[model samples]
Target chain A: MSLPNPSFAPIDWERATPATLLERIAEAKIVGMGGAGFPTAEKISLTRKHPPNIVIANGMETDPDVNADRVLLEQHLNEVLTGLRIVARILSAVHSYVVTSHKKTIQVAQGCLNDNETVRYLKPTFQNGAERELIQILTGHVVKDNRFPAFDGYLVLNVHTLFAVAEAIAGKPLTKRLVTVHDETRWIDIATPVESILESSDPIRVGCYATGHRPRVNEVLTATVNAISTDKSVHALPCIHCGWCDEACPRDVPVESLFVMAEQLKPNLDAQDALNRCNDCGACVVACPSNIHLLDHVRALRQRNDIEWERISRATQARLRVDAREQRMRSDVIRSDTKRTERMQQQHKWQ
Target chain B: MAVTDRPKFQTTGIMVHVVIALLPGLGVGAWFLGHKVFLVVLVSILAAVATEAIGTRSVQTLRDGTAVVTGMLIGLCLPPSVAIWVPFVASVSAIALGKLVFGGLGKNLFNPAMVGYALVLIAFPMQLVYLDGLTGATALDVLKHQETESLQQLINHPAFGLVGAKHFEWMNLAFLVGGLYLVLLRIVPWLLPLSVLLGIAVPALVFLPLYDATYSFGSPWFHLFAGGTMLTAFFIATDPVTSPSAKLPQIIYGFFVGSVAFFIRCFGTWADGFVFAILLANAFLPLLEPKKVALDN
Candidate 1:
């Protein structure tokens, strides 16, 4: 499909405040198309609060099977670059980057970069594609646990989102996206029923086959849905503890231990580290020799962890309540004893 | 982290590679040991496959090819001189007891082949010995029995060749070459076999100077190439399902297996103590596993 030519309007960069730009982006309804469908406007707003922010146009498709990003970059390089600069202008950032793993995408982006902009190719791996890992790789700054990359002045947005941002500036709505149907790429409308995309009842995952999930009943295409894979089987063998999952984990989670914990459907304090570190990238799933869905196990353990945490919190609250009551009673008894001693002293003096 | 680097292998594919790698060593063994070695190996393979089929009651389970590999390993571990029934019994136990009892394949704690071999060796110690009409004492036997012979004189014995046992050294060399192929293909990690060798060598070297040359416990070279040392290092102890998988744990496990095996060969009556050492190491696997390795980077 051809690129949309919506109603065009010239940009007035001088008048574009960060708030106005965020509003436009919010109106566009853009999100992180390459990864989790987080609201792009809120992400930009978060990064904007931290000045001297660095904007990264994420042109790299981390999924090994999906090359939709490369095609998007090749087809709509202008709009993507414009969208990146719009974010940079919105943040008044120090610099901007256009990072992709594809050689062709790098070449396409490199020519249009300004003096403040840089484009480079990073070797494609699951870890490098992740947000925190990508930030660490590019900037050598580790995003701490429970912290967002925005705290470090890093704004990462997918190229598709940028395309929408530019279109939003030109007065257009985000109605269609590039969906990888089987092997071919097509412009699929937002909220299109997943069943209509592929007629086969054969099992299908809603994302990249390597790391995606089965579509929920009547699930439709959203910004996060990148690929439709139809060849997966629901059946999986028992985990052999081969340690391939451990080797394949980008987050350095001890997946084998987690798998053991998951097998019992109970959360163990022993595997708490693994449960915290795992982001469910599905790298372990791809690496498993037994065709086991290791992510499902990790997810199961995480749910158990949540329940365990709830019980622990309740117990801790009960313990604190008892401790507080004991302290109060002790203080009250001491105060009463001091009053009684004062009364005795008064009586002795009178005698 | 790059899943795309190596491609096109599953349980079936890996077992097939293992079987292919065993060919050179199996060929060398039959060439030196006798035609009966092939008979023994074939009987073991048949028994293991049949047992696996019966245990699971599904032909699809046989497609995994683990039963064949288990049979081959049991056959190789046994002496060719044993009766045909011995091979059958070992193969059955290797599949049914060693593997199937513990839920088969990856679930078993001990090396399947060693479980069967160790059981039969304990039960029928006399039957497990190698006794050709040409020479009764194997290389390890010569080391233990020749009290009057000095180290120099022992080298000239008919059982001894160059730096190792006459027929066994060739088989060991064949197994070593095949093992290197597995390592090169990245089918098996190199740390496992290398650490195992280092484990045995360090102890052998340390004890060499302590003992009198007249009553030497064989040189490090002889220890490496003698008995089932090479086979154990490469094939048996390196089994991923049974052995420790993490780097630090694997090194410790390999070293422990090697040192114990060496100590048993030198002090105990058994000609080769690898089976016991491996099972013992397998027992300690959980303790050796690294608790957690947080990514520093």
Candidate 2:
């Protein structure tokens, strides 16, 4: 289906059914461009049943250092556009938006758009690209208190993700990604596979927290890789809640509250309202005054609690369904017996 | 056996409770400072931990939460405009000079956070004031520099007798709220802030009639609010290492801090007095050791 002025840069396009979107994602091996190495196809397959109405291209490179999106827009605008169009088409989105900061980048992207009617630009704010926060601002729709962008009819993608989507349509697999390595002193450019990038470079001396893992040539670049070490030993101490993290959080989630809630013996839903909405951005870890491993703890608690709670809920629901089925069968059996008894009595009277 | 066994208090649990008790003040600080504050805090704390690890030449991660506490206190003391590197520097100083030099955490006599703050203060006094202040109004600037003099002349300045006194008063109120939270939570015993307040106040009261009676005892409150007074009360003076462990010694330590703080505020060339007083008190901490109880009596 032709979308009204779809924003894809004019390279190529592929029409994918929900099934095709998943199949192509896996075949292309497209990975999450927002630093996570998760296979894009896996994410697409999981969320395909629930189509997103609004699509966001997250450009808020709040890292203060990394500027790949800015660079991509500056140079590869058309290529990125073609990918965005494909996503919008597949998702059946009403509106597609680009979230970015660099003025020059937005200008360049806009210029390349050739006045595509469906796409608009969102000025970059701190944490502006966080999927949930971006969705809230763009669509004014918040997902279920504990849910994510998928719940709000919004699908948020990074500039890199769009680039990957375009490549996938072109039948190119995701084999490499752009990694910005810089510190108080130097910036280096290297193109290595997702697993090899960490192994190729030395750990940076500063801003390790932002990097998420320590720079070591031997370490594997995991899904949640940061330039710094995330080991408990290297992780900063617990939060003293100086409000720095909450204030610094560009997404404006209560990171400290999430930490406190995770520590509570009995999880109080009201108390943990903050964690339920957390976007898992490492910004809070950066802001914590006590250098609390805030994101780590919050994410761990969220994952653990989410899994346990979901299991219990599913089990309960299954049990109820089984019991209801049994009761209905018993009622049916009694009714059948009553009919048989009447039939036998009528036969005897006739005789 | 006679029922003469004394109950064993859970010291570890008590310490944890003390750390836990600090959360409310922390929450209030976070509420005001926002997420950026957390970033500064985390960086400073990580920097502090790294510094201690590197300084001691050990791979061991410092636990006791002392370095973290120090980094946080320093972060709170610092103005938001402070470069990220400044916190890194302060954290290092707090852990290295303030804590590790004497030993780690509880063994140190001087508050590590103040040491870090003092280091930054020395290195970047200009940066310590928020960007808003350089562009707008800061409480101390109004009081010390006569920023509100034009308005004062118009109203006769009766409320505060000074042009910016009213504004400074509110800033002081914010600090007081921060300070009270610390005290109420028992993060730092009241003796430190109370004694420091008294130390500064009693002298101001005694000298007010002789020096400048118009400013009077209220000048002490102004002094408390003007610069880092409240911050120091909640953060610095309460440094576990720098202050005596014994209650009476802590009171005496606070008294000295008050007196010296008053002296610096009254006679020193600078407007702020916490650092000089803290450093002076740190020197006296050894003399007030618990083992020296016989000498004191």
Q: Whose TM-score is greatest here? A: 1
Stretches of candidate 2 off by over 4 Å are A1-31, A35-54, A63-65, A89-94, A117-126, A139-153, A182-196, A199-241, A250-254, A257-272, A303-351, B1-297
Q: For model 1 chain B, give the 10-residue run with minimal summed lDDT.
A: B288-297
Regions of model 1 farther than 4 Å from truth: A1-19, A181-183, A199-202, A230-235, A318-351, B1-8, B134-136, B211-213, B290-297
lDDT of 1 by residue, B6-52 (tens): 55356667779888889999999988988888998899999999999
Mark the 10 consecutive residues where model 2 chain B has the least summed lDDT.
Answer: B1-10
Q: In candidate 2, what are the lDDT values of residues A52-163, reduced to their tens digit?
A: 4666777666553455566666666676777777777776666778767667766666655533323445554445656666777777877765665565466777777787
lDDT of each: 0.81, 0.58
lDDT per residue for candidate 1 within A1-351, as digits (tens), equals 546544334346446776777787886678888768899999998988887799888876767567788778889999898898889988988988888887887776677779999987887777766777777777788888788989889988888889888887766677888887777888889889987887776788887776777779999888778788774435455455567778777778988877766777667766777688777777877777667777777887888888998999999999999999999999999999999999999999999
